[model samples]
Target: MGKVGPPITGLPVMPSDLPLDEVPEDVLREVLEEEKRIYRNRSYKKKPYPTSRDVMEAVREALRVSTRIHPDEFPDVVLHILESKGFEVRHVTVKRIWRAYETLVRKGVIRDELGVMM
Candidate 1:
């Protein structure tokens, strides 16, 4: 009968050498071309922004309230209050509110909060 060996033991061995510092030229070129193709496809596409009716209604409410109150006087506070009142006023939902806030800031409705437009 052939000699039998004992079961393997201890931790597995690892490679002693490090990988290449940079990708090979051909591979890099292929990656770059793929990225360019993806960019071109995305650029040609007309991506739509958020435009929910509930969000629009929230924006209208903000606009109506903003007209009477100074936007800068307390933009965050006012928004918080409206949110507390259950306006569903999320940054995502109130994109129009952000736009109106920016307009209000430009029109002196509120001081520029960190100069953020939205």
Candidate 2:
């Protein structure tokens, strides 16, 4: 009878101890590309994340509710007040809020000092 080898353990596991350079170039590139794609998608999703329209609405509501306090008195404070007013504060990111203020000021929708637009 022919000599038989001992039963083999399921497929040999890749040793993590081995240096990465030994891995094939194609394998390495595939892994790197996968990671790059994930990052790229994440960034793309975040681009234009905060829209100007949402900020405008938030500013409008904030000012409308806080009639006694001026919008220019404390911008950040007004933001918190607006949030408490039940406005979707998440839509009003810092960048968006700033843009909204700039647009309102430019278009004369709201004044910087008068507290309300003319």
Candidate 3:
């Protein structure tokens, strides 16, 4: 065998550098909270999606055209409609559409007569 290097040892390790199992729970929680705070402070480059009102309006229009479909199809149909209108449909957007649908139903903006909000 060729010459081997000496086994590694003797490095200064901070408390944060300790193995996860060795770190105290309180310290880990503090570190996690700090990381979250730092992340929230960072600026993001992507453009934000359309306002909730706009999304809700799109969902309403889509529902109008899909009146006979089952209620469970609402999110997927709305996503397709939004994408067809040149909006980027993300999972978040789909979730927002479902939430807006519920809000509209609670506010009486969409009615069961129209087969839209039920």
Specify the highest-lDDT model's number.
Answer: 3
- The worst-scoring run of ten residues by lDDT in candidate 2 lies at 44-53
TM-scores, all candidates, are: 0.27, 0.36, 0.50
lDDT of 3 at 65: 89
Q: Mind giving the per-residue lDDT tens digits that candidate 2 earns over 1-67?
A: 3333444675554445356557799988999999999988877432233245655766776667666
Error of 2 at 90 (Å): 5.5
Question: Candidate 1: deviation at residue 107, Å?
Answer: 1.5
Q: What would you estimate as the lDDT of candidate 1?
A: 0.53
TM-score of 3: 0.50
In model 2, what are the clashing residue pairs, if there are any? Answer: none
| Residues 22-79 of candidate 1: C-alpha lDDT, one tens digit per residue | 4489987898999999998877543233344443344455555655554454346545
- The alpha-carbon deviation from the true structure for residue 90 of candidate 3, after best TM-score superposition, in angstroms, is 1.8
